[model samples]
Target: MTKIVVFDSGLGSLSIIKAIQKISKSEIIYFADQENYPYGKKSQAQLSKIIQNSIMLIEEKFFPDFIVVASNTPSLMLNVTTKKIFDVKPPLQDAKKKSKTKQIGILATKSAINSKGLTQYIKENNFSKKFNILKINGSELVDLVESGKFISNKKYCNKIIKKVLEHRLSQNNIDVVTLSSTHLPFLKSLLKKQYPKINFIDPADIIATKIYLKIKNKQSKKNSLKIFVTGDIKKFQTKLNKIGIKKKVNSLSS
Candidate 1:
């Protein structure tokens, strides 16, 4: 069984890990740098350094066959640098040729949306002309989910859905809404309910598929998973159980 590591800023990456486990047989290791719960607010230099150090640590201990950066902030901030440093590529870069509409809207944290790294990436890739990037701050949804408020707060959930739809509509000709934050997938049903006409793209599926493809050609011993977080273990465990992950959960000191 091949080993794969999934790293996120918080519990949001659980969505991605769930998707991956559904489709693949690989052993998974899930790590949440919850002490730094919001990578979005960090500077590019800070993000780069932290991500490099994290990757180095993961590599040393897990020796994963593939590592998935499942956080949108880190994905956008460190994709290029991580690839260069680790000699690994992200699946988003290799996603199928997008539709000609060239319009892309992102639903991420405010910080990620405001990042110079993302802006430069769009500009450098010439996506500015073909793609119109729109960002929606969905960090609140993360808090809600983590707090176990998603199922109970129907009105609030609807409000968020409405806002996301409105934001997407504001960007004319947007054909794709990038679920930039890992947490956004939990709201997929609500998104479709409010805006069935719009296409919502979750990078997790793409990332998982890419990992599957990479490991397809390699042979390795089977592995299991250990989930670590720098937060309330009982709370984290409850959230994981809510999402159907019953793995052993560990708490890390901040």
Candidate 2:
């Protein structure tokens, strides 16, 4: 079977894992680096070290075919992509195509929003001058999902979503918004309900397709997933249970 490793700071990795399962039969090892939760708040230098260490540790311990850094903050704010390494990035092209007003919003974490890397990424995409790219800080919403509040406390999540995105999206008349953070996808249904007219784009399926295409020829057997966390296993397991992920979460010892 094709062995793959997918990881992020917290529960966000589940979004990518779920998507990958839909299209490919691969053995997956999911690492939740909750010890370094909120990658958004770190400096680029700090995040670079954390991501590099995590990547080295995961590779050393798991020795999977490839590894996925599933967080948008590190993906967009640092030079972390390689042949067998994949990172999640906002689907700006898709947003541009879907947007009638040409004002597309990228809902990502704080560090990603403020990073020069993200700005350069947009520029590299060669979006026309008519296209307006709005970067919104969604760290609070990411926290909601990481803390298990998105599932346990809908009303509160709704409030934070409105507080963080509603005004900015409405003011700019952004017809399309990309859920840039993997954690943000957990709030998609709520976001759609609150902003009915705006089209929310999720990159999970795109990411999944990319991974599936790469490993599909390997002839994997039944799909399987093993989870690990760098933080409290008991607490993280409880959070996972709330989201219906009943798999055993092992402690990352590397």
| lDDT assessment of candidate 2 | 0.91
Instruction: Please give the distance, in angstroms, between residue 196's alpha carbon in candidate 1 and its true position after superposition.
Output: 1.0
| Deviating ranges (above 4 Å) for candidate 2 | none
Q: What is the C-alpha RMSD of each candidate to the true structure, in Å?
A: 3.6, 0.8
TM-score of each: 0.81, 0.98
Best by TM-score: 2
Estimate the overall C-alpha local distance difference test score of candidate 1.
0.67
- As a TM-score, model 2 comes out at 0.98
lDDT of 2 at 177: 91
